[model samples]
Target: MFLPFSRYLAFALLSIHETVCTELGTSPFNLRPFSINLSSGVRTMLNKIKTTELPHFPEYPGVGSSFGIDLNTLKSLRKEWLTSFDWGKEQDSMNQFNHFEATIEDLTIHFIHEKSSDPDAIPLLLLHGWPGSFLEFLPVIDQLVQTATTSLGKSISFDVIVPSLPGFVFSSPPPANWTVHDTARVFNTLMTDVLGYSTFAVHGTDFGVGPGYALYDEFNKTTRAAHFVFLPFYPLKPDALQALNITLSPLEKFEEQEFIQWDSSGSGYFLEQSTKPNTLGLALYDTPVGQLAWIGEKFISWSDPHAGTGGSVLDSNEILRSVSLYYLTRSFISSLYIYAQNPHGFATEYTKAHTNAPMLFSAFKYNVAFWPPALAEKVGNLVLYRNHESGGHFPGLENPSALIEDLREIGTYWTT
Candidate 1:
């Protein structure tokens, strides 16, 4: 929470430099500091789930029973969430960081901005995916903002910015005509106009990857660098993979098999959200437990089994916090619209073109799509690519320390 005097001095110096450089261009946009204040009605609904009567059916037999979140697991989680969880404390903890809202092209965008005391800290933008809020990055946020010296004696720090993507929780919903490209333009304004950062780095996962890629592709001059855990685009064909001139290791082969299995059995959510989000969202909107079952399934299944032995790789509180935000803000339905808006998917030839800006990829061992290092090169000016042994799709939550360390390495490519 506190930086050393030397580190504080470094931050102060950088802050002065940033002020001088950014002050030259007056921002056309306005950014107002905001706070989280859950309404009493929403809080009451979240707390009443324990007493609400849930539908019951006879347990199905065999492996098929695990096809969805087991009813008992939901019941137990509901009990704990209502009885043991404390939303007030959690809200206060989140409020500890700086939060702001900016109206970008008529839509209100909510974000957390934690400026490092080290004036030289690189400005970094973090994007979160579906079923995830800014909460995903909370575990590693402090480490990123604090000044630290790496093993090689490199001083590393960042001016961290984590935003709720359009229509996710606090952020306003995207217009019907809006796509990820539109979101990209707004976020670009957010960085250069609202925050007055001339250039910044980006990291994204899941749905966030779409906007992240859009920013890198469409605004390479200002988006100086990027890192991604998910690229929402189609994987390269076998022939194309062969063209990369790299052989797959046994571990890589195993990852391929896992991906195949996942695509076959685990992608139903995609179809529903992309095609008929409203139909399902309306059905689940009134029932908190229903939303839990729908979103909680992915949190449990998509995470690495080895990451946590309990119900999910993420703790109960983490999962509930995400769901609670959606419920309280009434953004669950709008969040699903991102899938519908980008029906063609994000793998365009334009996105595939390489940029001069440095790009990095961190492929988690248990991620749904296993993008080999060879295939990743075709996408960008690939500078750093690393594979982890034990994280899944939600690395920010499943493995924060690893995510933080990888993000810190991005500073190596930062230019003045």
Candidate 2:
């Protein structure tokens, strides 16, 4: 029942969705305001999909899902999406956040600005990375607004702001050469100039680490403290490590080996997106089934293996929501531009904060990359580092409770 729309049909559907949304006032990028939802036409098309038509290929011998997305799992997920997934429910949940748009450099920035009623609540910028939208942090917003207490009974809470990274859902696409450093400047403006916060905190993961680090480094005066579940450091190859005479402990060896294996095997997305994203985007962005396989594979391969939701930790519902947003906003291709615009890919250069802001990092066991504390220390003032046996790259989705606690704990050291 799985069929890819012809490239023309796929792009047409994409264009229709965008055009229809624009015409209906569902997604107005004029910077006034906007709401998010899958159009009725698109929903009908999705519901009418023939999942059973997907050609069944024999599963690869022994490799299973290690090589790519498992067709069987994808079929099951697609069926679930077509038959049982509820976009309205997900959209309602997202609407619970105070969403607003602000124009920055001619780009309309969409963000969730949820302030805790507590007057003393700390302002924290929660940034999401690629293949993820503001949806990544929705699960933890309720918890973040609650009073967070320390062992001493001292309490804290957060006024959370989650922005759709430029070119992401609801946010207008960026101009060429828009690096995360540029994003960092825009975000600072959002927090300071637009939101009118004199001091704030930050938490980042994946590509989010770029802007989060820039705010932590370049705007140390306003960015009081920061936290991260991932960083942007480039992993040195085995030869490079040997050349530097770098010694690895047994655990570091295991981690480094995992990284090497990922670089050799799992880095096609990075290379393709960085070098020739338009081709990749043209091929997949407009097709729902194609989008499913492309994004769905990452959710499968990059998540904690022993966890639930078909080994992805989070459920297919979230995956479907991701696919839906990418489709409705026609943002998949533009989202990849972050990679194309910042062609250095990961980093040989580590971020150094100019001020002594407390930086907390949570090292999730299943995350795609691991930088030991020694190297990570070079990136900032490493005040709090927690090693977790659970979670992965999308910790906000995979382990929201853990991510929430990490965010909560960051406040304890805010003034230290």
Candidate 3:
């Protein structure tokens, strides 16, 4: 049986505190400098994927027949990834940023710590969701950290912290029974106890929203503000929509149509991941092409259609880098366990007016899930909500400039 939200939060906090003291011999955790050096053995395995022959299947021309990633797209990506893509170059680019690890509870969390020169910069925690590693934030971290002159002539910046969720990429996997709430508690320890910040703001999309909401609810005093590109527990009830006293706009209606269509046909991955993750996990573990097909399909489908082009908004290199990380670390299977552990989904009770932290929501045009401004207001102290004309689920990569500008707006609300 699942525990009540309040009890779960309390127990999680106590557990993290005890683990920190016992393991590290300190009440608060400490950050240890780290480096990411991929082994030669892993590199050899990745190179082997390029030469491996993929089985050919005849294509039929129809939406249902092509319900998944087209065979042609996967073949092209595999060829380029094997022959031309440079993992070393990508690794060096990632290493240019400050990276560190800290033991919080039973997991050793890996994160990028980018600091701004501005003394007044606020600490901002950026979290990434499934099929996405901390890599999703790489394109925008520099802009977020750079000092920007506002309309009032004041400068603003952020001390950005992007962590690999436990069991994803560099972070160690949690116990078999771990849930998102467990991640939330460990992350709170990261900010307050490890990093020594009394208050911070959070921004998240996809699975990141689970822990993001957890922080907003359980540590409102410390999580001073929150911003989201996706709210996992949304589509407010009909009565809740009535309470907001507003009608859906044309854009919102389009979002609804898209959402319904996806729920009917595109939710197979969700059901499988949340129910029999290990079963699927084992099947895909040793096969590089299988992992690519599973993850690359989402990257292609969920992104905004390329403007004036016929494919995904993401470039070839962008998609390959994400897949390469999973393939290299052999952590693809562990990442899926997060879904199995939290089969019930994000806690709905926390979504109901649990905190007064200033909240902001951005609805990207092509996101699978969309929440209107009125509906968003019911969840928290809705301070700013906007609809974008471009971008999709992965706004950080698809439209970095837009995402950065909106985050700066959050900084203004935070300082005021």
Candidate 4:
């Protein structure tokens, strides 16, 4: 799980429309809420799929989709996409939540702002990582805003702010030199200045861990706490763990091997996306099926096979919805910009610990990136940590209930 420590200095967006950046200071009035309907161009592209064809894939594999996404799965997804997947209905469902666009730092940031009726609801920011969009949060956004009284008899709810990290969906792209640090700064501004929250709790996974940690480190006074499903910085090495008189549990050892296997077979996209984005971006920008196979591979490889939210079991419909949105908005490539702009993929710092903010981590057994709790505790003020046998990378999709519970639990530590 250990890579070079210096690489994190690099890893770090695109716009749907042409919103020019003017010198306007941040304000809530600058934001506009609206519904997004499928455009004529996107509708035509989806229609063309019925007649257009995908080439056949010759059989060559031990496991289906192990080397890459297998052909059979790819075709199956396309079939579901054409038949049962309804983008208009899905768009209507998404629009039910309050979606907004605001000009901040010359970038038109897109986000889902769901506020609970509870005047005392905890202000929380939920950040999504790569291989996901703001859509990933759709399953749980409504649930998160609902009032919940924990088993401990504590009542809690959230004013959830889920922003599309600069270049992913409708949000504008960052400048070429921007990194996650820049993202952290802008997001801090969004929460405190733009939305005008006095304080907020943060949760992150995958690519989100970078900016989430950055907010925790830099804006200690405003960002009260953090909960993460993944930490870019890893736990201490096995030898280092032993020297520290710590022993790995059987599950930890097994997960470590699984993590290694993932690096070998499942992570080629990271390198290509990080090192040569433009070359790869052009190749799949327009081809729907191609984009499907490319992004479709990760949802299968990273999830707990039996896991997901509600009836939405991270199924073909769900997968295609993700790819289709990215394809239609022309953001599949723009999202990849984070990789190239920040080449420090998994090599984030493991040694430094900042305790100003209370840190809670949700450790899923199959997350691919494994870190022991003992070493993880050294990274921050480890207040609450839980391990789950279910869910993988995108908990918002895989286990919305668990993700929601964790966010509520973390919110309790915040004081007025």
Which number leads on TM-score? 1
Candidate 4 lDDT over residue span 55-168, tens digit each: 676467556665788878777877887887888777766666667777778888888777777888888888889889887788787777788876466888888888999888
Task: Show the lowest summed lDDT stretch of 10 residues, model 1.
Answer: 6-15
- lDDT values, one for every candidate: 0.80, 0.78, 0.79, 0.75
Q: What is the lDDT for 291 in model 1?
A: 84
How many pairs in model 2 have backbone atoms within 3 A of each other, for residues 3 or more apart or on separate chains, i.e. clashes? 7
| Model 4 lDDT at residue 170 | 83
Clash number for each model: 4, 7, 0, 5
**Candidate 4 Cα outliers beyond 4 Å, as residue runs:** 1-29, 47-52, 57-63, 235-244, 308-312, 353-355
Evaluate model 1: give its lDDT.
0.80
Model 2 over residues 1-416: C-alpha lDDT tens digits?
A: 22223323433443455567668875433333345655664754484455325666744656668778877888888888888887777776666555677777778899877667688999999999988989888878878877878535669898888999999888889888899989999999888776668999999988888888888889888999999877767867667677766776665666666677777899899888898989989987657788888898887677776555432347778888888888778888999899988877477876667989998888776777877666678878897777766677788888887788878877778772
TM-score rank, highest first? Answer: 1, 4, 3, 2
Off by over 4 Å in 2: 1-33, 44-53, 59-62, 236-254, 309-313
Candidate 1, 116-153: lDDT as tens digits: 87888889999999899999898788899888865456
TM-score of 3: 0.87
Candidate 4: which pairs clash? 7-344, 10-342, 11-342, 13-167, 14-167
Q: Evaluate residue 339 in candidate 1 and report its C-alpha lDDT on the 0 to 100 scale.
A: 90
For candidate 4, report its TM-score: 0.88
